[model samples]
Target: MKSTKLYFSALLCTLFLFTGCKDYVRGNGNSNDRPDIILTYPELVSMLQHYDKTRKQQFAAAVGKDEDTRINHFNLKDLKDYIAYIEKECKKKNIPLTGINFISGAYPDNYRLDPKKSNYQALIMMPATTIDGEENVSFDPFKSEKGKPLSLKEILEGYSYTSWTYDELKSRKSKKKSSRSTQKGGGNDLSPAGNRTGISPPN
Candidate 1:
Protein backbone atom coordinates (compact mmCIF):
# COMPACT_ATOMS: atom_id res chain seq x y z
CA MET A 1 0.00 0.00 0.00
CA LYS A 2 2.86 2.44 0.77
CA SER A 3 4.62 1.64 -2.54
CA THR A 4 1.34 2.20 -4.49
CA LYS A 5 0.77 5.63 -2.83
CA LEU A 6 4.35 6.79 -3.61
CA TYR A 7 4.00 5.71 -7.25
CA PHE A 8 0.70 7.60 -7.66
CA SER A 9 2.22 10.77 -6.11
CA ALA A 10 5.22 10.63 -8.46
CA LEU A 11 2.92 10.19 -11.46
CA LEU A 12 0.84 13.21 -10.43
CA CYS A 13 3.95 15.37 -10.06
CA THR A 14 5.21 14.34 -13.55
CA LEU A 15 1.78 15.02 -15.09
CA PHE A 16 1.65 18.52 -13.52
CA LEU A 17 5.13 19.41 -14.78
CA PHE A 18 4.35 18.19 -18.29
CA THR A 19 1.12 20.15 -18.43
CA GLY A 20 2.88 23.34 -17.18
CA CYS A 21 5.61 22.98 -19.81
CA LYS A 22 3.04 22.48 -22.58
CA ASP A 23 1.15 25.57 -21.49
CA TYR A 24 4.34 27.64 -21.45
CA VAL A 25 5.28 26.47 -24.95
CA ARG A 26 1.80 27.14 -26.31
CA GLY A 27 1.74 30.66 -24.81
CA ASN A 28 4.79 31.75 -26.87
CA GLY A 29 4.41 29.47 -29.91
CA ASN A 30 3.41 31.93 -32.59
CA SER A 31 5.99 34.63 -33.40
CA ASN A 32 4.04 36.09 -36.33
CA ASP A 33 1.39 37.78 -34.20
CA ARG A 34 1.57 41.58 -34.66
CA PRO A 35 -0.56 44.61 -33.84
CA ASP A 36 -3.62 45.16 -36.05
CA ILE A 37 -3.44 48.96 -36.21
CA ILE A 38 0.00 49.07 -37.85
CA LEU A 39 0.00 49.45 -41.66
CA THR A 40 2.76 48.62 -44.13
CA TYR A 41 4.28 51.08 -46.60
CA PRO A 42 2.49 49.51 -49.58
CA GLU A 43 -0.85 49.81 -47.77
CA LEU A 44 -0.20 53.50 -47.10
CA VAL A 45 0.77 54.09 -50.73
CA SER A 46 -2.47 52.48 -51.95
CA MET A 47 -4.52 54.65 -49.59
CA LEU A 48 -2.78 57.82 -50.76
CA GLN A 49 -3.41 56.90 -54.41
CA HIS A 50 -7.10 56.38 -53.71
CA TYR A 51 -7.29 59.71 -51.89
CA ASP A 52 -5.61 61.48 -54.83
CA LYS A 53 -8.13 60.04 -57.28
CA THR A 54 -11.07 61.06 -55.08
CA ARG A 55 -9.67 64.58 -54.62
CA LYS A 56 -9.22 65.01 -58.38
CA GLN A 57 -12.84 63.97 -59.00
CA GLN A 58 -14.08 66.36 -56.33
CA PHE A 59 -12.03 69.21 -57.74
CA ALA A 60 -13.37 68.61 -61.23
CA ALA A 61 -16.96 68.61 -59.95
CA ALA A 62 -16.41 71.79 -57.94
CA VAL A 63 -14.81 73.71 -60.78
CA GLY A 64 -16.86 74.01 -64.01
CA LYS A 65 -13.70 74.32 -66.10
CA ASP A 66 -12.21 70.96 -67.00
CA GLU A 67 -9.19 72.45 -68.74
CA ASP A 68 -5.93 72.35 -66.77
CA THR A 69 -5.28 76.01 -67.54
CA ARG A 70 -8.52 77.06 -65.83
CA ILE A 71 -7.92 74.71 -62.90
CA ASN A 72 -4.30 75.79 -62.57
CA HIS A 73 -5.52 78.69 -60.45
CA PHE A 74 -7.30 76.21 -58.20
CA ASN A 75 -8.34 77.46 -54.74
CA LEU A 76 -5.17 77.42 -52.60
CA LYS A 77 -7.28 78.88 -49.77
CA ASP A 78 -9.50 75.80 -49.72
CA LEU A 79 -6.51 73.44 -49.54
CA LYS A 80 -5.12 75.33 -46.54
CA ASP A 81 -8.48 75.11 -44.75
CA TYR A 82 -8.67 71.37 -45.43
CA ILE A 83 -5.23 70.93 -43.85
CA ALA A 84 -6.38 72.91 -40.80
CA TYR A 85 -9.39 70.61 -40.37
CA ILE A 86 -7.10 67.56 -40.54
CA GLU A 87 -4.86 69.06 -37.83
CA LYS A 88 -7.83 69.73 -35.53
CA GLU A 89 -9.13 66.17 -35.89
CA CYS A 90 -5.66 64.68 -35.25
CA LYS A 91 -5.33 66.78 -32.06
CA LYS A 92 -8.73 65.56 -30.80
CA LYS A 93 -7.61 61.96 -31.31
CA ASN A 94 -4.17 62.62 -29.71
CA ILE A 95 -2.42 61.43 -32.86
CA PRO A 96 0.70 63.21 -34.07
CA LEU A 97 0.15 64.10 -37.77
CA THR A 98 3.73 63.61 -38.89
CA GLY A 99 4.87 62.09 -42.24
CA ILE A 100 2.04 63.85 -44.07
CA ASN A 101 3.54 65.32 -47.25
CA PHE A 102 1.85 67.67 -49.75
CA ILE A 103 3.48 68.80 -52.97
CA SER A 104 2.21 71.14 -55.75
CA GLY A 105 4.31 72.07 -58.79
CA ALA A 106 4.04 75.11 -61.07
CA TYR A 107 2.88 74.99 -64.67
CA PRO A 108 5.35 74.94 -67.54
CA ASP A 109 6.11 77.89 -69.85
CA ASN A 110 4.46 76.20 -72.84
CA TYR A 111 1.09 76.01 -71.01
CA ARG A 112 -1.43 77.64 -73.32
CA LEU A 113 -4.02 80.22 -72.34
CA ASP A 114 -6.57 78.72 -74.74
CA PRO A 115 -9.79 77.36 -73.21
CA LYS A 116 -9.40 74.17 -75.27
CA LYS A 117 -6.01 73.44 -73.69
CA SER A 118 -6.00 70.19 -71.66
CA ASN A 119 -5.91 70.55 -67.86
CA TYR A 120 -2.68 68.50 -67.88
CA GLN A 121 -1.02 71.20 -69.93
CA ALA A 122 -0.73 73.55 -66.99
CA LEU A 123 2.65 73.69 -65.22
CA ILE A 124 2.57 71.74 -61.96
CA MET A 125 3.53 73.95 -59.00
CA MET A 126 4.97 71.01 -57.01
CA PRO A 127 4.68 72.83 -53.67
CA ALA A 128 5.59 70.59 -50.75
CA THR A 129 4.51 71.02 -47.13
CA THR A 130 4.03 68.89 -44.02
CA ILE A 131 1.54 69.02 -41.11
CA ASP A 132 4.18 68.70 -38.35
CA GLY A 133 4.36 72.37 -37.44
CA GLU A 134 3.37 74.27 -34.27
CA GLU A 135 0.78 76.30 -36.17
CA ASN A 136 -1.21 75.53 -39.32
CA VAL A 137 -0.01 77.24 -42.50
CA SER A 138 -2.37 79.20 -44.77
CA PHE A 139 -2.36 80.36 -48.39
CA ASP A 140 -4.65 82.54 -50.50
CA PRO A 141 -5.04 82.01 -54.25
CA PHE A 142 -7.84 84.55 -54.45
CA LYS A 143 -7.24 88.21 -53.62
CA SER A 144 -9.95 89.89 -51.57
CA GLU A 145 -11.33 93.35 -52.41
CA LYS A 146 -9.27 94.76 -49.51
CA GLY A 147 -6.25 92.56 -50.50
CA LYS A 148 -6.44 90.83 -47.08
CA PRO A 149 -5.85 87.10 -46.66
CA LEU A 150 -9.11 85.17 -46.77
CA SER A 151 -10.04 82.75 -44.00
CA LEU A 152 -9.32 79.21 -45.28
CA LYS A 153 -12.30 77.72 -43.40
CA GLU A 154 -14.74 80.06 -45.14
CA ILE A 155 -13.25 79.38 -48.57
CA LEU A 156 -13.08 75.58 -48.28
CA GLU A 157 -16.13 74.40 -46.28
CA GLY A 158 -18.21 77.53 -46.73
CA TYR A 159 -18.68 77.83 -42.92
CA SER A 160 -17.28 74.81 -41.09
CA TYR A 161 -14.50 72.52 -42.33
CA THR A 162 -14.66 68.72 -42.26
CA SER A 163 -11.98 66.79 -40.34
CA TRP A 164 -10.27 63.41 -40.66
CA THR A 165 -7.69 61.57 -38.49
CA TYR A 166 -4.83 59.41 -39.79
CA ASP A 167 -3.04 57.36 -37.13
CA GLU A 168 -0.10 55.05 -37.93
CA LEU A 169 0.62 52.64 -35.08
CA LYS A 170 4.09 51.09 -34.67
CA SER A 171 4.40 47.29 -34.79
CA ARG A 172 6.59 45.89 -32.01
CA LYS A 173 6.78 42.44 -33.56
CA SER A 174 8.04 43.74 -36.91
CA LYS A 175 10.52 46.03 -35.16
CA LYS A 176 11.82 43.14 -33.08
CA LYS A 177 12.27 40.96 -36.15
CA SER A 178 14.13 43.77 -37.91
CA SER A 179 16.37 44.24 -34.88
CA ARG A 180 17.14 40.52 -34.72
CA SER A 181 18.04 40.41 -38.41
CA THR A 182 20.28 43.45 -38.02
CA GLN A 183 22.03 41.91 -35.00
CA LYS A 184 22.54 38.57 -36.77
CA GLY A 185 24.03 40.36 -39.79
CA GLY A 186 26.69 41.93 -37.50
CA GLY A 187 25.74 45.58 -36.85
CA ASN A 188 27.97 48.14 -38.63
CA ASP A 189 30.61 45.55 -39.61
CA LEU A 190 31.35 47.36 -42.90
CA SER A 191 33.44 50.31 -41.84
CA PRO A 192 35.00 52.89 -44.23
CA ALA A 193 38.24 50.86 -44.20
CA GLY A 194 36.38 47.68 -45.15
CA ASN A 195 34.74 49.48 -48.11
CA ARG A 196 37.95 51.14 -49.34
CA THR A 197 40.18 48.09 -48.81
CA GLY A 198 38.28 45.03 -50.02
CA ILE A 199 39.99 42.87 -47.31
CA SER A 200 37.69 41.48 -44.60
CA PRO A 201 38.91 39.84 -41.38
CA PRO A 202 38.40 36.06 -41.19
CA ASN A 203 36.82 34.88 -37.97
Candidate 2:
Protein backbone atom coordinates (compact mmCIF):
# COMPACT_ATOMS: atom_id res chain seq x y z
CA MET A 1 0.00 0.00 0.00
CA LYS A 2 2.89 2.40 0.80
CA SER A 3 4.61 1.60 -2.53
CA THR A 4 1.39 2.18 -4.46
CA LYS A 5 0.94 5.57 -2.84
CA LEU A 6 4.51 6.55 -3.76
CA TYR A 7 3.96 5.49 -7.41
CA PHE A 8 0.70 7.49 -7.64
CA SER A 9 2.37 10.60 -6.15
CA ALA A 10 5.20 10.38 -8.70
CA LEU A 11 2.74 10.01 -11.55
CA LEU A 12 0.77 13.04 -10.34
CA CYS A 13 3.97 15.14 -10.13
CA THR A 14 4.92 14.19 -13.70
CA LEU A 15 1.46 15.05 -14.96
CA PHE A 16 1.61 18.50 -13.30
CA LEU A 17 5.07 19.16 -14.79
CA PHE A 18 3.81 18.27 -18.30
CA THR A 19 0.77 20.51 -17.86
CA GLY A 20 2.92 23.48 -16.75
CA CYS A 21 5.32 23.05 -19.71
CA LYS A 22 2.41 22.89 -22.13
CA ASP A 23 0.94 26.14 -20.72
CA TYR A 24 4.30 27.91 -20.97
CA VAL A 25 4.73 26.87 -24.62
CA ARG A 26 1.14 27.82 -25.44
CA GLY A 27 1.55 31.29 -23.87
CA ASN A 28 4.60 31.99 -26.07
CA GLY A 29 2.58 31.28 -29.26
CA ASN A 30 -0.36 33.48 -28.21
CA SER A 31 -1.16 37.13 -29.12
CA ASN A 32 0.16 38.34 -25.76
CA ASP A 33 3.72 37.67 -26.93
CA ARG A 34 4.94 41.07 -28.12
CA PRO A 35 8.31 42.00 -29.67
CA ASP A 36 10.92 43.83 -27.63
CA ILE A 37 12.38 46.17 -30.25
CA ILE A 38 10.93 48.62 -32.73
CA LEU A 39 9.77 47.45 -36.16
CA THR A 40 12.74 46.70 -38.42
CA TYR A 41 13.94 49.21 -41.06
CA PRO A 42 12.67 46.97 -43.87
CA GLU A 43 9.21 47.10 -42.31
CA LEU A 44 9.29 50.93 -42.22
CA VAL A 45 10.43 51.05 -45.86
CA SER A 46 7.58 48.79 -46.95
CA MET A 47 5.05 51.00 -45.09
CA LEU A 48 6.53 54.15 -46.63
CA GLN A 49 6.31 52.59 -50.10
CA HIS A 50 2.63 51.81 -49.60
CA TYR A 51 1.97 55.36 -48.35
CA ASP A 52 3.89 56.84 -51.30
CA LYS A 53 1.90 54.80 -53.81
CA THR A 54 -1.52 55.60 -52.37
CA ARG A 55 -1.17 59.08 -50.87
CA LYS A 56 2.07 60.65 -52.05
CA GLN A 57 0.50 62.97 -54.60
CA GLN A 58 -2.21 64.12 -52.22
CA PHE A 59 0.34 64.59 -49.44
CA ALA A 60 2.54 66.64 -51.72
CA ALA A 61 -0.38 68.89 -52.63
CA ALA A 62 -1.32 69.39 -48.99
CA VAL A 63 2.24 69.63 -47.76
CA GLY A 64 4.94 70.11 -50.38
CA LYS A 65 7.87 67.68 -50.54
CA ASP A 66 11.40 68.08 -51.82
CA GLU A 67 14.88 66.71 -51.27
CA ASP A 68 15.07 69.19 -48.39
CA THR A 69 11.49 68.55 -47.20
CA ARG A 70 11.16 66.63 -43.90
CA ILE A 71 8.61 64.66 -41.94
CA ASN A 72 8.35 64.80 -38.16
CA HIS A 73 9.14 61.72 -36.08
CA PHE A 74 8.18 61.81 -32.41
CA ASN A 75 10.40 60.05 -29.91
CA LEU A 76 8.67 57.28 -27.95
CA LYS A 77 9.91 58.66 -24.66
CA ASP A 78 8.88 62.25 -25.37
CA LEU A 79 5.39 61.18 -26.47
CA LYS A 80 4.87 59.08 -23.37
CA ASP A 81 6.19 61.79 -21.09
CA TYR A 82 3.98 64.41 -22.72
CA ILE A 83 0.92 62.19 -22.30
CA ALA A 84 1.72 61.65 -18.63
CA TYR A 85 2.23 65.38 -18.06
CA ILE A 86 -1.07 66.16 -19.75
CA GLU A 87 -2.83 63.57 -17.62
CA LYS A 88 -1.40 65.05 -14.43
CA GLU A 89 -2.45 68.58 -15.40
CA CYS A 90 -5.92 67.36 -16.35
CA LYS A 91 -6.33 65.59 -13.05
CA LYS A 92 -5.42 68.76 -11.12
CA LYS A 93 -8.07 70.73 -13.01
CA ASN A 94 -10.66 67.96 -12.54
CA ILE A 95 -10.73 67.36 -16.34
CA PRO A 96 -11.13 63.92 -17.83
CA LEU A 97 -9.14 63.04 -20.96
CA THR A 98 -10.93 61.02 -23.57
CA GLY A 99 -8.41 61.25 -26.44
CA ILE A 100 -5.87 63.41 -28.23
CA ASN A 101 -6.56 65.82 -31.09
CA PHE A 102 -4.08 66.14 -33.92
CA ILE A 103 -4.38 69.34 -35.94
CA SER A 104 -2.60 69.70 -39.29
CA GLY A 105 -0.31 72.70 -39.68
CA ALA A 106 2.08 73.96 -42.36
CA TYR A 107 5.10 76.12 -41.79
CA PRO A 108 5.48 79.39 -43.64
CA ASP A 109 8.21 79.77 -46.29
CA ASN A 110 10.16 82.01 -43.90
CA TYR A 111 10.25 79.09 -41.46
CA ARG A 112 13.34 77.96 -43.40
CA LEU A 113 15.14 80.94 -41.90
CA ASP A 114 15.46 78.77 -38.78
CA PRO A 115 18.26 76.46 -39.83
CA LYS A 116 17.61 74.04 -36.95
CA LYS A 117 14.08 73.16 -38.02
CA SER A 118 13.44 70.25 -40.41
CA ASN A 119 9.68 69.86 -40.29
CA TYR A 120 7.72 71.64 -43.05
CA GLN A 121 4.46 70.09 -41.87
CA ALA A 122 3.50 69.58 -38.27
CA LEU A 123 0.78 67.77 -36.34
CA ILE A 124 -0.15 70.03 -33.45
CA MET A 125 -1.51 68.00 -30.55
CA MET A 126 -3.98 68.90 -27.82
CA PRO A 127 -5.64 66.82 -25.14
CA ALA A 128 -9.38 66.36 -25.64
CA THR A 129 -12.24 65.85 -23.16
CA THR A 130 -15.67 64.51 -24.02
CA ILE A 131 -19.10 65.43 -22.64
CA ASP A 132 -21.96 62.91 -22.43
CA GLY A 133 -19.92 60.61 -24.68
CA GLU A 134 -20.83 62.80 -27.66
CA GLU A 135 -19.26 66.25 -27.64
CA ASN A 136 -15.46 66.56 -27.52
CA VAL A 137 -13.56 69.66 -26.42
CA SER A 138 -9.81 70.12 -26.71
CA PHE A 139 -8.09 71.81 -23.78
CA ASP A 140 -5.85 74.38 -25.42
CA PRO A 141 -4.34 76.85 -22.94
CA PHE A 142 -1.94 78.31 -25.51
CA LYS A 143 -4.77 79.44 -27.80
CA SER A 144 -4.25 83.11 -28.52
CA GLU A 145 -4.16 85.43 -31.53
CA LYS A 146 -2.89 88.58 -29.79
CA GLY A 147 0.59 87.25 -28.98
CA LYS A 148 3.43 86.61 -31.36
CA PRO A 149 3.43 83.20 -33.06
CA LEU A 150 5.42 80.57 -31.18
CA SER A 151 8.71 79.50 -32.74
CA LEU A 152 8.85 75.72 -33.14
CA LYS A 153 12.44 75.81 -34.39
CA GLU A 154 13.45 73.72 -31.41
CA ILE A 155 10.94 71.03 -32.37
CA LEU A 156 13.13 69.37 -35.05
CA GLU A 157 16.46 69.91 -33.28
CA GLY A 158 16.83 66.54 -31.54
CA TYR A 159 15.34 63.79 -33.74
CA SER A 160 17.31 61.87 -36.38
CA TYR A 161 16.01 60.64 -39.74
CA THR A 162 17.31 58.71 -42.76
CA SER A 163 16.57 60.40 -46.09
CA TRP A 164 16.61 57.52 -48.55
CA THR A 165 14.94 57.81 -51.92
CA TYR A 166 12.22 55.38 -53.05
CA ASP A 167 14.65 53.52 -55.33
CA GLU A 168 17.11 53.06 -52.48
CA LEU A 169 14.47 51.35 -50.31
CA LYS A 170 13.67 48.79 -53.06
CA SER A 171 17.33 48.02 -53.69
CA ARG A 172 18.30 47.44 -50.07
CA LYS A 173 15.34 45.21 -49.08
CA SER A 174 17.13 41.83 -49.50
CA LYS A 175 20.43 43.09 -48.07
CA LYS A 176 18.64 44.46 -45.00
CA LYS A 177 16.89 41.11 -44.42
CA SER A 178 20.16 39.09 -44.25
CA SER A 179 22.01 41.69 -42.18
CA ARG A 180 19.04 42.24 -39.85
CA SER A 181 18.60 38.49 -39.33
CA THR A 182 22.11 38.25 -37.85
CA GLN A 183 21.56 41.38 -35.73
CA LYS A 184 17.86 41.17 -34.77
CA GLY A 185 17.68 37.56 -33.49
CA GLY A 186 16.11 36.38 -36.77
CA GLY A 187 12.73 37.81 -35.77
CA ASN A 188 9.97 37.73 -38.45
CA ASP A 189 12.40 36.27 -41.01
CA LEU A 190 9.93 33.54 -41.93
CA SER A 191 7.23 36.16 -42.56
CA PRO A 192 6.95 37.85 -45.96
CA ALA A 193 8.40 41.36 -46.22
CA GLY A 194 7.28 44.37 -48.28
CA ASN A 195 3.70 45.59 -48.73
CA ARG A 196 1.67 42.38 -48.55
CA THR A 197 -1.58 44.26 -47.88
CA GLY A 198 -2.54 44.10 -51.61
CA ILE A 199 -2.48 47.88 -52.02
CA SER A 200 -1.08 48.98 -55.40
CA PRO A 201 -0.65 52.22 -57.30
CA PRO A 202 -2.63 52.75 -60.51
CA ASN A 203 -0.90 51.49 -63.64
Candidate 3:
Protein backbone atom coordinates (compact mmCIF):
# COMPACT_ATOMS: atom_id res chain seq x y z
CA MET A 1 0.00 0.00 0.00
CA LYS A 2 2.94 2.34 0.75
CA SER A 3 4.52 1.75 -2.71
CA THR A 4 1.16 2.31 -4.48
CA LYS A 5 0.59 5.56 -2.62
CA LEU A 6 4.14 6.83 -3.59
CA TYR A 7 3.52 5.97 -7.27
CA PHE A 8 0.19 7.88 -7.34
CA SER A 9 1.86 10.93 -5.70
CA ALA A 10 4.63 11.00 -8.38
CA LEU A 11 2.02 10.86 -11.17
CA LEU A 12 0.14 13.75 -9.62
CA CYS A 13 3.36 15.83 -9.40
CA THR A 14 4.07 15.22 -13.11
CA LEU A 15 0.55 16.31 -14.11
CA PHE A 16 0.89 19.52 -12.10
CA LEU A 17 4.28 20.38 -13.67
CA PHE A 18 2.95 19.74 -17.19
CA THR A 19 -0.07 21.98 -16.67
CA GLY A 20 2.06 24.78 -15.19
CA CYS A 21 4.52 24.65 -18.14
CA LYS A 22 1.67 24.70 -20.67
CA ASP A 23 0.13 27.78 -19.02
CA TYR A 24 3.48 29.60 -18.97
CA VAL A 25 4.08 28.95 -22.66
CA ARG A 26 0.56 30.00 -23.58
CA GLY A 27 0.88 33.23 -21.66
CA ASN A 28 4.15 34.21 -23.40
CA GLY A 29 3.20 33.14 -26.93
CA ASN A 30 3.25 35.68 -29.84
CA SER A 31 0.42 34.29 -31.95
CA ASN A 32 -0.91 37.76 -32.79
CA ASP A 33 2.33 39.01 -34.38
CA ARG A 34 1.26 40.14 -37.84
CA PRO A 35 3.24 41.83 -40.64
CA ASP A 36 2.13 45.36 -41.59
CA ILE A 37 3.33 47.33 -44.62
CA ILE A 38 4.45 50.93 -43.99
CA LEU A 39 5.19 53.62 -46.55
CA THR A 40 8.67 55.14 -46.99
CA TYR A 41 9.35 58.89 -46.83
CA PRO A 42 9.70 59.15 -50.60
CA GLU A 43 6.41 57.35 -51.13
CA LEU A 44 4.68 59.65 -48.65
CA VAL A 45 6.14 62.76 -50.27
CA SER A 46 4.99 61.65 -53.71
CA MET A 47 1.56 60.93 -52.33
CA LEU A 48 1.36 64.39 -50.76
CA GLN A 49 2.45 66.06 -53.98
CA HIS A 50 -0.19 64.26 -55.94
CA TYR A 51 -2.80 65.01 -53.34
CA ASP A 52 -1.89 68.72 -53.31
CA LYS A 53 -2.20 68.98 -57.08
CA THR A 54 -5.57 67.26 -57.03
CA ARG A 55 -6.72 69.54 -54.23
CA LYS A 56 -5.64 72.70 -56.06
CA GLN A 57 -7.41 71.60 -59.20
CA GLN A 58 -10.59 70.70 -57.38
CA PHE A 59 -10.57 73.91 -55.38
CA ALA A 60 -10.12 76.07 -58.49
CA ALA A 61 -12.90 74.25 -60.32
CA ALA A 62 -15.32 74.51 -57.40
CA VAL A 63 -14.54 78.19 -56.77
CA GLY A 64 -15.15 78.94 -60.47
CA LYS A 65 -11.58 80.01 -61.07
CA ASP A 66 -9.73 79.10 -64.26
CA GLU A 67 -6.44 78.64 -62.39
CA ASP A 68 -5.41 77.80 -58.84
CA THR A 69 -5.19 80.79 -56.47
CA ARG A 70 -2.23 81.26 -54.17
CA ILE A 71 -4.60 82.03 -51.35
CA ASN A 72 -6.60 79.02 -50.20
CA HIS A 73 -10.26 79.95 -49.62
CA PHE A 74 -11.72 76.61 -48.71
CA ASN A 75 -15.38 76.05 -47.86
CA LEU A 76 -16.88 72.97 -46.27
CA LYS A 77 -16.99 71.11 -49.59
CA ASP A 78 -13.36 71.94 -50.29
CA LEU A 79 -12.34 70.66 -46.88
CA LYS A 80 -14.27 67.42 -47.45
CA ASP A 81 -12.62 66.94 -50.82
CA TYR A 82 -9.20 67.47 -49.32
CA ILE A 83 -9.94 64.97 -46.56
CA ALA A 84 -11.16 62.42 -49.09
CA TYR A 85 -8.05 62.90 -51.21
CA ILE A 86 -5.82 62.33 -48.20
CA GLU A 87 -7.81 59.23 -47.24
CA LYS A 88 -7.44 57.77 -50.73
CA GLU A 89 -3.69 58.44 -50.78
CA CYS A 90 -3.26 56.89 -47.37
CA LYS A 91 -5.11 53.79 -48.46
CA LYS A 92 -2.94 53.45 -51.55
CA LYS A 93 0.16 53.68 -49.36
CA ASN A 94 -1.32 51.39 -46.70
CA ILE A 95 -1.17 54.22 -44.15
CA PRO A 96 -3.96 55.14 -41.75
CA LEU A 97 -5.18 58.59 -42.77
CA THR A 98 -7.62 58.87 -39.88
CA GLY A 99 -4.64 58.78 -37.53
CA ILE A 100 -3.53 62.26 -38.61
CA ASN A 101 -4.52 65.11 -36.26
CA PHE A 102 -4.72 68.89 -36.74
CA ILE A 103 -5.56 72.05 -34.78
CA SER A 104 -6.77 75.51 -35.78
CA GLY A 105 -7.16 78.99 -34.18
CA ALA A 106 -5.99 80.33 -30.84
CA TYR A 107 -5.95 78.62 -27.48
CA PRO A 108 -9.21 77.61 -25.72
CA ASP A 109 -11.13 78.56 -28.90
CA ASN A 110 -9.91 76.27 -31.64
CA TYR A 111 -10.98 73.23 -33.63
CA ARG A 112 -8.99 69.99 -33.64
CA LEU A 113 -7.99 68.19 -36.79
CA ASP A 114 -7.82 64.41 -37.13
CA PRO A 115 -4.93 61.92 -37.18
CA LYS A 116 -2.84 63.80 -34.59
CA LYS A 117 0.88 63.19 -34.64
CA SER A 118 2.29 60.62 -32.20
CA ASN A 119 5.87 60.93 -30.91
CA TYR A 120 6.52 63.46 -33.71
CA GLN A 121 6.04 60.83 -36.39
CA ALA A 122 3.60 62.52 -38.77
CA LEU A 123 3.48 65.14 -41.53
CA ILE A 124 1.56 68.30 -40.68
CA MET A 125 -0.10 70.92 -42.87
CA MET A 126 -1.46 74.21 -41.57
CA PRO A 127 -3.56 76.78 -43.39
CA ALA A 128 -2.11 80.29 -43.27
CA THR A 129 -3.46 83.79 -43.87
CA THR A 130 -2.25 85.48 -47.03
CA ILE A 131 -0.95 89.02 -47.47
CA ASP A 132 -4.17 89.99 -49.21
CA GLY A 133 -7.38 89.88 -47.15
CA GLU A 134 -8.64 87.00 -49.30
CA GLU A 135 -8.58 84.23 -46.69
CA ASN A 136 -8.97 86.40 -43.59
CA VAL A 137 -11.13 84.81 -40.90
CA SER A 138 -12.16 86.46 -37.67
CA PHE A 139 -13.16 85.10 -34.29
CA ASP A 140 -15.50 87.07 -32.05
CA PRO A 141 -13.96 88.33 -28.82
CA PHE A 142 -14.80 86.37 -25.69
CA LYS A 143 -16.01 89.48 -23.81
CA SER A 144 -17.24 92.81 -25.14
CA GLU A 145 -16.70 96.06 -23.27
CA LYS A 146 -19.29 98.89 -23.50
CA GLY A 147 -17.35 102.15 -23.77
CA LYS A 148 -15.97 104.66 -26.25
CA PRO A 149 -13.31 103.28 -28.52
CA LEU A 150 -9.79 103.71 -27.26
CA SER A 151 -7.91 106.78 -28.52
CA LEU A 152 -4.61 106.53 -30.41
CA LYS A 153 -2.67 107.43 -27.24
CA GLU A 154 -4.47 104.70 -25.29
CA ILE A 155 -3.75 102.22 -28.06
CA LEU A 156 -0.07 103.21 -28.16
CA GLU A 157 0.24 102.88 -24.39
CA GLY A 158 -1.00 99.28 -24.52
CA TYR A 159 1.13 98.33 -27.55
CA SER A 160 4.53 96.70 -27.09
CA TYR A 161 7.60 98.88 -27.69
CA THR A 162 9.10 96.25 -29.97
CA SER A 163 5.99 96.25 -32.16
CA TRP A 164 6.17 100.04 -32.67
CA THR A 165 7.76 101.57 -35.75
CA TYR A 166 10.66 104.01 -35.32
CA ASP A 167 8.41 107.00 -36.01
CA GLU A 168 5.78 105.80 -33.58
CA LEU A 169 8.32 105.23 -30.84
CA LYS A 170 9.82 108.71 -31.42
CA SER A 171 6.36 110.31 -31.37
CA ARG A 172 5.49 108.59 -28.08
CA LYS A 173 8.77 109.69 -26.54
CA SER A 174 8.18 113.32 -27.67
CA LYS A 175 4.67 113.27 -26.23
CA LYS A 176 5.99 111.95 -22.90
CA LYS A 177 8.60 114.75 -22.79
CA SER A 178 5.96 117.37 -23.58
CA SER A 179 3.73 116.01 -20.81
CA ARG A 180 6.57 116.16 -18.29
CA SER A 181 7.44 119.72 -19.36
CA THR A 182 3.83 120.84 -19.04
CA GLN A 183 3.63 119.37 -15.50
CA LYS A 184 6.73 121.44 -14.60
CA GLY A 185 5.15 124.70 -15.88
CA GLY A 186 7.52 124.79 -18.89
CA GLY A 187 4.89 124.61 -21.65
CA ASN A 188 2.12 126.96 -20.32
CA ASP A 189 2.61 129.20 -17.26
CA LEU A 190 -0.66 130.22 -15.48
CA SER A 191 1.23 132.72 -13.21
CA PRO A 192 -0.05 136.36 -13.28
CA ALA A 193 1.94 138.47 -15.74
CA GLY A 194 2.84 141.22 -13.18
CA ASN A 195 2.88 139.41 -9.84
CA ARG A 196 5.13 136.56 -8.65
CA THR A 197 2.70 133.77 -7.76
CA GLY A 198 3.18 132.41 -4.14
CA ILE A 199 2.46 128.86 -5.54
CA SER A 200 5.58 126.76 -5.28
CA PRO A 201 6.88 125.31 -8.61
CA PRO A 202 6.35 121.56 -9.20
CA ASN A 203 9.43 119.55 -8.24
The prediction achieving the highest lDDT against the true structure is: 2
What is the lDDT of every predicted structure here?
Answer: 0.36, 0.44, 0.34
Candidate 2, clashing residue pairs?
A: none
Q: Model 2, residue 43: displacement in angstroms?
A: 13
Question: Per-residue lDDT tens digits of candidate 3, residues 45-74?
Answer: 998798677775675576444433232233
Task: Arrange candidates, best lDDT first.
Answer: 2, 1, 3
- lDDT for model 1: 0.36
Which rank order by TM-score, best down to worst?
2, 1, 3
Clash numbers, per candidate: 12, 0, 8
Worst 10 residues of 2 by lDDT: 191-200
Model 1, residue 50: what's the lDDT?
Answer: 89
Q: Which residue runs of candidate 1 sit more than 4 Å off their true CA positions?
A: 1-74, 103-203
How many pairs of residues in model 2 come into backbone collision?
Answer: 0
Off by over 4 Å in 2: 1-50, 61-64, 67-71, 116-119, 132-136, 141-203
Kindly give the stretch of ten consecutive residues in candidate 1 with the minimal lDDT sum: 194-203
Q: TM-score, each model?
A: 0.19, 0.39, 0.17
